[model samples]
Target: MPTTDTTTTDALAQVVAQRFTDTPLRVGTRTSPMALWQAGHVADLLAKRVPGLRTELVGIETTADNWPGDLAELGGKGLFTKEIDRGLMAGQVDVAVHCMKDVPGDVPLPPGTAFGAYLTRDDVHDVALFPAASPIRRLEDLPQGAKVATSSVRRRAQLHQYRPDLRIERIRGNVNSRLRKLDEGTDGFEAMILARAGLGRIGEAGQRPYQLLPMEHQGKKVAVLPAVGSGVIGLQARTADAPVMALLDELSDPDTAACVTAERVMLHMLLGHCNSPIAGHCVRTPDGREFHLRGMVFNRDGSRFVHAAAWHKDPATAGSLVAADLLRQGARDLINATKN
Candidate 1:
């Protein structure tokens, strides 16, 4: 028998190991412009962190595709995630990227799949956009009975709290469509609410002198709290998937994960589902040594609700404490009643 070349075999082994280390990963995400942008952003980050890394975005149209009705009418759970989850379990995709806010709390993931990691968070505040020609810069500036477009229970409830007189109209479509509608006076809307992070990611706002623009498109923050998990990108992978899970861990942001954890905990504790009008936000100190969490729940009409706040060195459990406080304040009653 011919003797094997030990040096050659060793060199080949090293090459194989390096290839495994720099393996290309396929990412699953919605086909929408913002979702594609997010997946591409993740791929860029992975390329920087893992030498020779590559990725392709696998567009998955979720159950919510072309959904024109309000979430309340549709039960509001898994509309954006059911199909993506199936892709991972079927080995069609290595991982799935989700809008943290769009992920539902009441539904647990299928067995053997889990939350892998979260990316760096963006702004967690809601933004108000209005026709620049109009004087409505904020919710308070709306004229009595002025129409505003939104499908979020959280926004509707908060708006009711601030301006009960304003009419909350249901609106749907992509970011560009919504802005165009607002400019075209669709549903006679004077203003609309959108997430600041979404607008910033797409650079949707224009730079013209205020009056000439169809919509002001300013990323002006509002007083209302954000939906739990907003501005955070939720990564999902099969629990049994060591290779993909490892890659996800490499790209994860621990600080943002901690904050979102606290907020999600509150969401879980409240049993929040779609159209529940629940909101939570958490923040870590600059040193990253401590976490502060705030949670709120309101009836759909904003007739009643409860708010709670807490802090801890460990961000994960801080949300639980805040939720407990809110429960003691009768948050469950408000949420349950709203659901009914």
Candidate 2:
């Protein structure tokens, strides 16, 4: 009755002990503060999940990080991710961390690479940052024809749709640089649009004065139809790295993965790129039984647009349905118009 399977117990212990060796997992990431924060977060997650695991960060400066001109002229959002992808394929890094929105949906991922996990989604709302001395507290308080700075085409188009009179100017650089430009009144930037999650990650959300812009004309409601994969951090690794993939699988958030997958499906169906004035978002219902997807396609100027929303028990199905509805309303024409 007291006989114990000591042999099986010892074997299991050995397997667990060898799972993580002394070799540190190298994580590749961009060199920006926000990017480093994201990589550190992933490392921390992995360490917490496996007590003995070690992670070392490899900072890689990306083309997008250095390019000052239009992102469209230099390809697209992939510029932000391609270098890190190369690190993964070349075996320089065991893992690559990327801001999911910066990943292009218009083309397939680099060959031999795959995403192992999508972290839990963060705040998807867009916020407006004003100069510390500015009197404006809300977007509505800004005078007509006021200058607003942002680097996102989607944000530009949506701002035009919401307030056509406001002048949108292109601003580039990391989060801190842009904020400095805004604070210093560079190029007469009265306000700037930024993602809420980014500011929070850099400890600038509540510490700095900002307003959460409304998605639609809903009075006083804080919301925004965010870009596809806006607030998710994706873990990418070589397809053949079974051990790393297994570790990453443990960090995947099911709900976040479902929502981001639906959003990406819609973006792919729409053939969206960095310059495409497209937006999509998905969320699980309160009861967690269905996925609700909202998709929008807009011309560069935002004078014309199409919107569609749908719900389904399946995330991909919900995305496809919404994409179909948008296409039926001439979404493809809008997307093409933006490209031209």
Candidate 3:
């Protein structure tokens, strides 16, 4: 990693000017603490890699920031991404860091914008946070009609398939709030499903008294298949934004990029969104060129499911191709059951 020389005003000025050249670069992110941390992490990595480069972090608020309403009714995943997109298009920010899962299946990036450069992913499994009875360890142990809270339609739809007898309930707010709901028993939620990575990030994973039942997606266990871009962080820049794009390239992880590319492509092809129980996972083979993907869709009630797997040449568009194949094989009907 490169370090900047900040010894003197003139030296710093010269260093900054030389590093940035004539064009300044800015990165935009959501206003949430996690978003800011993500932005700062990117900024530090970029600055360290490109000595003297002056990068500004801009915090922009989006619908998810202002409204506490249901995420499902938002219709698109853009609620979390559009603000940054606008910042890029308006020249307010040159690049943006995004949690890829929040990006919709079909994003109309402005003509000049492009996505590349991803950080390594984190744990993608969903953990169950329960309060009493340590012996009630896994999903099977939860009594019938046990109330499980989650906001994701995806989780709700899938959980129903496994334990239809278990009561599913809605939960809003961030990880901490949901955990508090369970611990305090004020929210009537016995347990809440949350991504283990999110909990670990906040340093609350160990404090929870409940056991984590690893989540599975598309027939692949969470430990085996990470949600598309689950631990990866993405940087997007305008195609014309050479300086920022080059900086991002310096921070890009080859393996992470390859996997997310395949995953996002699969998602884009399937038109899967936050509301869909559709899930996908992609992994790179040891040789680093080949990729494998698993995709699945569950009936609205989670009583039925379709699974597909595919292998692809270095790129791994096979995931999307597999999803398309599944859709051709009654996935549409199973998914449509949600509307009924």
Candidate 4:
């Protein structure tokens, strides 16, 4: 076979001369500290992906900050993203960078709005964090009837399944706030759980000895999932904006995007929301040519559960196939019973 670098080099030069010209873009993000960091990171990436692409971060507040009222009492889906979508609707921002885990499965976007691409993924496992002085070494180490703080139903269900005697309190606020509460041992929370990726992104990982996710108990390895799209940032844009979408297309990571696509398929097929006690985790084969999805559905109280796994050449169908297996194993009854 004959090989030449000239053709590839020439093609790159043409792309740079043509589509990579100077352009401006806007990114919408929430006002939380982590959200600011995310938006800033996207800004830096856009600058590198598109030549002379100027970006402005537009701060928008969403339901993530809505305290004193549970998201279940308010609206569950789209709380963190609806405001950003509004910005897109009014032409204020070109696209919104969102925490994919918070995005709902059923909400319809504006006529022109569409999910763009996902950035590179991070550690998808959740973590257990406790104060440095705390004696809690493992989840099983928590004293009987001790308080566990978290607002996520998925976490609550798994925790309940593991330790039914421990109290699962509905703790809300930003990552820092919850950590502070847990550190102070106020609200009776001896420990709290957070995503390892979230802590790492905010420069907080390894600050203390934190417990990593995919935990085990009673000599049995239990699969605990970070929320869907836990480590991936989703880009939402008006498909009508060609230049903005083109720039974002370059930012999309194929492997991360494909895995999250599989994860979302399970969430959507289950009709799950933050309030639903459902969880999933997906891993690629060593050769990177296949994906296996581990799916679990638990009753609200963790009283009943079903788990199943399957392999698929297509990441998108991996979730669907496993979800079907789970349904057959009685996931549908558990979900319906919880709904009622």
Pairs in steric clash, model 4: none
For each candidate in turn, the TM-score is 0.86, 0.93, 0.84, 0.90
lDDT of 1 by residue, 257-321 (tens): 88888998888888887868888888887786799888888998887888888879987689899
Clashes of each: 0, 0, 4, 0
Whole-structure CA lDDT of model 1: 0.77
Candidate 3, residues 276-310: lDDT per residue as tens digits? Answer: 67767777777766788777777666677787888
Q: Could you arrange the candidates by TM-score from highest to lowest?
A: 2, 4, 1, 3
Residue 138 lDDT (model 4)? 76
Clashing pairs for predicted structure model 2, backbone only: none
Most TM-score-accurate candidate: 2
Off by over 4 Å in 1: 1-24, 132-135, 205-222
Better of 3 and 4 by lDDT: 4
Better of 3 and 4 by TM-score: 4
Each prediction's RMSD over C-alphas, in Å, is: 7.3, 4.5, 4.8, 3.6
User: Best candidate per lDDT, number?
Assistant: 2
Q: How many clashing residue pairs are found in candidate 1? A: 0
Q: Give the Cα-based TM-score of candidate 1 against the true structure.
A: 0.86
Task: Give the alpha carbon lDDT tens digit for every residue of 1-340 in model 4.
Answer: 1122655534543463354356447789998888889999998987765445567899988765764567877777578787888999888888899888888865666789877779888888878787667877677777888877778888888877778897888887888777877777657678788888889878899677887767334354334766777788988888887666655666788778888888888878887755677777777889887997887888887878888787889987998897788888988788777654
lDDT of each: 0.77, 0.86, 0.71, 0.77
